[model samples]
Target: MSTTDTSNSPITNRRRGTLQLWSRTLIPTLREAPAEASTPSHRLMLRAGCIRQVGAGVYDFLPLGMRVLQKVSQIVREEMDAAGASEMLMPAIVPIELYAGTKRDVDYGDLLFKLTDRHGRDAALGPTHEETVTEMAKGSVTSYKQLPLNVYQIQTKFRDEFRPRAGLLRGREFLMKDAYSFHTTVEGDGGLNETYDRMYQAYVNVFTRCGLDFTVVEAEAGPIGGSASHEFMVNAETGEDTILVCPETGYAANVEKCEIGDRDWSFDTDATTDLTKKHTPGMPGIDLVAEHLGVKPEGMLKTIVFAKIGGDKRKYVLATVRGDHDVNEGKVRDVVGFPIALADEKEAKEAGFAIGYVSPRMAATRDDTLLVIDPDATGGVWATGSDEKDHHVTGFIWARDLGADLPTKDQQGGKIRVADVRNAGEGDPSPRLPGAKLVARRGIEVGHIFKLGTKYAQAFDFTVLNEQQKKTTVIMGCYGIGVSRTIAASIEQRHDEWGIIWPVPIAPYHVVITVMDPKNDEQSKLADKLATELVEAGADVLIDDRNERPGVKFKDADLIGLPVRLTIGDKALAENCVEFKLRSEDGKGRLVDIADAVKETLSKLA
Candidate 1:
């Protein structure tokens, strides 16, 4: 007897039957989450038996979790396809040499998971595929005909996180939907910008379809190395990222990229107190020194030293800001137009500079040392480092102490520059609105899109012939959606104290039929009938047929947080009705006739 080919047969197209029996599936709900589960989503994921921890930063998505993942993936696929992007898959393991051009191996540091294959060749589990995708475009896409093509993949990515404590929010291995677009130009129709805008809208649609309330904020590309980027954030109190929002102007940005508006700084120039040096032993940090001198932190100057990454001649930068603020290294790097790192203790000391007490006047100590002061720090008569060990200078004004030293022109030969180099905080003036203040809000970053502007194209030499038949480097854009992180972030935003309140689109099942007394034939028969009707009406249904108490069944239904719930019991079934409830609402559900149970459940789901 020969077996029929079922792979291409109609049997494959048949539904696996949307009705899932509670006893037939594995959902081991727990009374408490593990000790390591700190975040709300992490705890709820464990309690609901959606996921189980295999190791730190590694998890096994149970049946219920897998269903949700599939739903999310499908939505992403639909949106991406609708946005004119082709879907493809790439290998998870990549050769280490591919990272040579961008030097992301060094940029990623220990976060890139390095490994050696059995052939003794060095490889890595890709944290991202920018290099790999660009290399692909370089080989086959040699003409403008293939220009403006966007390709994407929904696959697993690995990162060697030092401490991945927030479950799927920061995991070693997680699913992602990453897309790369290649184009010959940046503006106009069918250009990189046009494709980028489409992808941005697609991202908005994906998250919105997933029932996520998110905000799009200006963001730094970080190690991704792009000209500009934006992040889609889900607002939550337990989120890791801090977003600064201008209430009046409706402008929002992540803390790292937030800009501050103009501000007034009053100087006490009439004090006439001479600049005096004082002994301050064991007070190296700004806090300790400020305490010893009895001055507020805002009235003190904090100087930091940084070394430029590459050049024939060594160059150092002295960045000074108010003690109350922090130096934003990204802004400093942008101002200098190069990569920079904090000067090591030995490097600073070897250059005839005090490690902690290097003052703004130290810029005059060496020709290669350039001072960059925050604009707000220029007017005040502040306390600052004296370039001497265990000592500080009091009553030091920038104009009085370094009048001729502050150069008018920005250069490296013993001159000072002024710019905004400090992190913008909660109440800082908004860059968009004149007098509005930026408010602080915590948000989880679920998606990011970048205008790469030939960064990866140059690395891979990915050039295509333009309309003029001349070779030109391709401009690129990268868009990413954190597939697994979205699930966790959704839980963070939608869960209640009782359990997760999954939205309709991504909920494991649209409706759960709770059999109050599974042993009763009437209750079981009614549940099965209602589940079948609901499934036929385009709703995923789960029937609770386990030999558990009615209270346990009700609690499980609430804990899993299906969008709609239908209860079949001795009392309700005898009355030819069932209790209909929506997980988002409070208190008990009203009765619905058994004849209209399926419609009522679908309506609730809608």
Candidate 2:
């Protein structure tokens, strides 16, 4: 079947047999979610008996959960195959040497699960396979003719999460579909971008078919360093990640990577004021200092001292921003081209800087220090540190007080650097369209695609001979969908107060036949016949054939949240019909003729 096929046709049915509830399996429905359940997805997953906790951040999928997971995986496989990607398997327990090639062992930090083998060799569970796949391509593929290959696997990955909460949303062990592409050159039609585009469309198809309401936003590559990347986020109010969106321009990005439009840094007033220092003892924070000076926070300049990490020389960096704004460390790292930490009191003191009373004027004196000034603080007259303990400077204008030599770019000695080092706030101008402002929303990241460039291939020495007979490194791209987390995210997006209202595509069963009383021969026969017909007509039918009370069966049916519910009761049978209800809708369903039940159910499924 084609990947784009949307109909619930028989050709797409993977499981042919019918499921009988109360006899064949277990669904331990609960009245209340466990106290630890924080999000809607976590609560619904447990109360519906879809999953059970094995440990902190570990979970065991029950039969119903397994079925849904399999269905989701099948959809992913179909879309990936349709995108011309080959499926393969890799060992989850990867050797530490693979990561050593990329130095990800240190980069991943405590999140990597490491172990010592019996042979005294180091091993670690794979959080991702960029290194492994790059190494494999390095050893196996060696010619341009064998380039432009994409390989993927649906497998479980492990990360030693410190706080794994929200059930499957942030589990230590979870299933993921990760695909890596290799190419000879990044230039033409048959290059990394071509495959990246195809994978992007494939992700769209998978999420659309799975009936998720999601947004594709530009994202930072985090630990998976890459040139360009995007995240597929399922929109929800309770989601952890913040996304900035511009509805007017249809531009969206994760907050970490979001860029804001230029701000009007021109002086609000041309009035000049001389820099004056005054003693204010023991003012601990910006709010307190602002109050001490009888000024608003926005009228103050915040100076922070940072020390460069992972460098041979210990260098102190000064970062300045508007007092109301917080410095985005990621942006600072991008500017400094190295990791940085807040300089300790002793380090700042030794560097000839006051720990809390440093000012932009110090940049003029300390030419060796790297100074990063936020755009908002460029030309404003503001209150700031006075380079003396227990003292602050008021009416400090950048042009007048900080000297004429200011760095417009990075790493220019003896000059103050100007850049956007502050976090983009809610009302900031949008980066894309003129006059548009950015709005913030919450989202759960279910999928991500990265344009990896040659970071991995270079590290692993993955190269191929080109048509010109010269050696060229392979450009790579990595795409991943959190298969299990997608399930939780869907629930987070789609569930109601009662239970999970599963989308038709990934729900364990499409139609649930509730026989009011199994002992009633007529009702029993009718339900069995309907199940068989529904199964043949490309619907997963679950028969609630338990010898339970009518109220019990109906409640369980509602809690299970099958798309369509067929209740075979004595009253409905006397009327020569059965009731058909859609779980998403309210009220009792209208009666349909017994002979027409199959056709009506099929119509609803369509």
Candidate 3:
């Protein structure tokens, strides 16, 4: 693509003159701001003139913003290519039947934006392209030699977020590039691991080049069924989710799995403490109960109920954590290993799972119900449940009162496995760093590469003939780049009070030639000469050919955030010199001969 052709869409380029090419050009900004926009990224995106509000959750990308979007897409393409991933386009629209076979289509519920086509067939704007890519891979490639096939596409994806906030970080209508890889057997594991690592590194490189400060931390595999997954977060103080890190150790995780600090607390064995039921009025929360009883919160067993798969009834579990600690439902969900969500009051009542009085003893009754308890809850003289509303039993011991049903070393029936299911928090010990603690930060996810093994291939019956003439379905993996979202993320992670700091690699025009006095004869000639030299020096050059004032031109240039600025004025015209400035540095300026400016810019870029 030629520089100008690639710069803007045909429609936008024509309007650049009339519309005035800047965020100030009809920017959709709010005065008081909406309460829904929770993060700086979300608010700034609107003020920066990058995106427009199409609806409550949807957005439309504008001209200058689209340039940054395309640049992010190019970087992703380069990295995926380096990782041996080939590129192809897939349809944004998908049929419902393909999703029905996999069951996720229905299971996804409201998240999938479902609609009917002109033909009256059910369809979904693809949230991801696992089904579509595998369907393509299955029809084309055959034999074990073609065992590992990878394909990707950068396209717009639609997801109906229950609450879409954080600007481009989360949106209803957004851009995402999803890639899928097909493998035949376990032998493909090496390449899979290799490419996964490569993609991870590539993600780092892409984010770094875009001038974003972020963290690649451990994350849970939600919805996507896999053993390993990583989350790239931008460190911002206003982040909604709490992340715990061990500052001492450098271990990091989302707060759900963030491990609490370990301490020694001995259970009282000698005292003949009575376990009596007592009314605890108006204390619905554990913290409230702990304060009322003059005991630590950890000294009590907290029960929570969850609605499970294939039933209207809810299952209740006694979640015992020290009052100082918190619950990790992700760990509980892993144990449940079924479709389960936090149970409501109605579901709990019908299932005989009490809302206020729930106990660990009820979990093991062979009554066709499930109970998974937190590990720290066991082997303690703690306050527990009476199974009656408004009453609890203190001085209750686990092994003495309800023995053998508690979880053991093995993850088996009626046994609560000791695992971290709570949200990982910053300052918590890093699981990988041993004794060290992790510091937390926020980040916008610009790209994602998933090793989608057989999730799609098995669904589509995507099979190929092997060398042995036997037929087998190809295993697959998928990767993606949110081309448009990256621009917003880059800005979120790397912006100033003024505007974005566009990097040299992606900035639309590397050098903006500001004709300080466009009408001045010498200044105009000097500006034209400088522009020609810069263009010849392999820099994408933009001349402020508009008859605007020097201050106005400078303001627009700064707002645009180009890396290099070349100013031509009366003082430079006489000496055949031009003023050059680097966008990153403080208002420092250098006078260079008109000829040397080109050489200097080319050298710096080189």
lDDT of each: 0.87, 0.86, 0.66
1 versus 2: better lDDT goes to:
1
Given candidate 1, what's the lDDT at residue 67?
Answer: 94
Query: For candidate 2, what is the lDDT?
Result: 0.86
Clashes of 1: 0
lDDT per residue (tens digit) for residues 1-606 in model 3: 235653366564232211122223443333434566656556655555556667866877765566667777888888778777788887878998878878879788899999998889999999987777666766777667875666777788899999886677778888876766667653435345556676778778777776666666566663445535666665655544455556655555565545555422333255457787778877878878777777877688776666565666434444445445666777777666766677777867776766777776666663556666555565657786677777778888866666565544543454444444455455555665556656666545555556666567777777777767888767555556676666666655555655556777777667877877667777767766666666644566667766766776666666666788888877875787888898776684788898788788767665
Candidate 2's residue-wise lDDT over 196-264, tens digit each?
889999999999999999999988754435537999999998899989999899888888888888775
TM per prediction: 0.93, 0.90, 0.81
| Global fold similarity of model 3 (TM-score) | 0.81
Give the C-alpha lDDT of model 1. 0.87
The better-scoring model by TM-score among 1 and 2 is: 1
Worst 10 residues of 2 by lDDT: 407-416
C-alpha displacement of 391 in model 3, angstroms? 4.2
**How many angstroms is residue 1 displaced in model 3 relative to the true structure, after the best TM-score fit?**
20
Clashing pairs in 1: none
Task: Please give, for residues 77-148, the per-residue lDDT of candidate 1 as tens digits.
Answer: 999999999999989999999976799989998999999988999888999999999998899898998878
